[model samples]
Target: MSVLYALAGLLIIAAVVSLVLSLLGVIVVGALRILPVVFVVLAAVFFLSGGRIDVHLPDKWRRK
Candidate 1:
């Protein structure tokens, strides 16, 4: 009887941890998927401003 109670307690704890980790994983994956879209929108905005805005790359990043 005591062993069964212990096992149940452990199962509950494991389930809670798994649920939290799954939620975090979902949030991180969503952010990563949306990042490119965010950048594209910003770039479009800059271009629509009629060359008033410019994006500069670092010296090492500049194409030869």
Candidate 2:
């Protein structure tokens, strides 16, 4: 009976971990999907602001 209880606890732990991981994966994917749109909007705002917005992006994101 003790071993069975231990196994049940392990199963519950595994299920919880899996649920958390899946939620994280979903959030990451959702952010990635919206990233391009975010960038576009930022770019628009930057240009409209005449470089006053200060996006502070990486150098690679800048055009030569």
Best by TM-score: 2
Query: Per-residue lDDT for 1-64 in model 1, tens only?
Result: 9999999999999999999999999999999999999999998987888757468889999888
lDDT of each: 0.94, 0.95
Cα lDDT over the full model 2? 0.95
Misplaced by over 4 Å in model 2 are 52-64
Q: For candidate 2, give the lDDT of residue 7.
A: 100
Q: Model 2: per-residue lDDT, tens digit, 1-64?
A: 9999999999999999999999999999999999999999999998888885455789998899
Which parts of model 1 are misplaced by more than 4 Å?
44-64
TM-score of candidate 2 to 2 decimals: 0.78
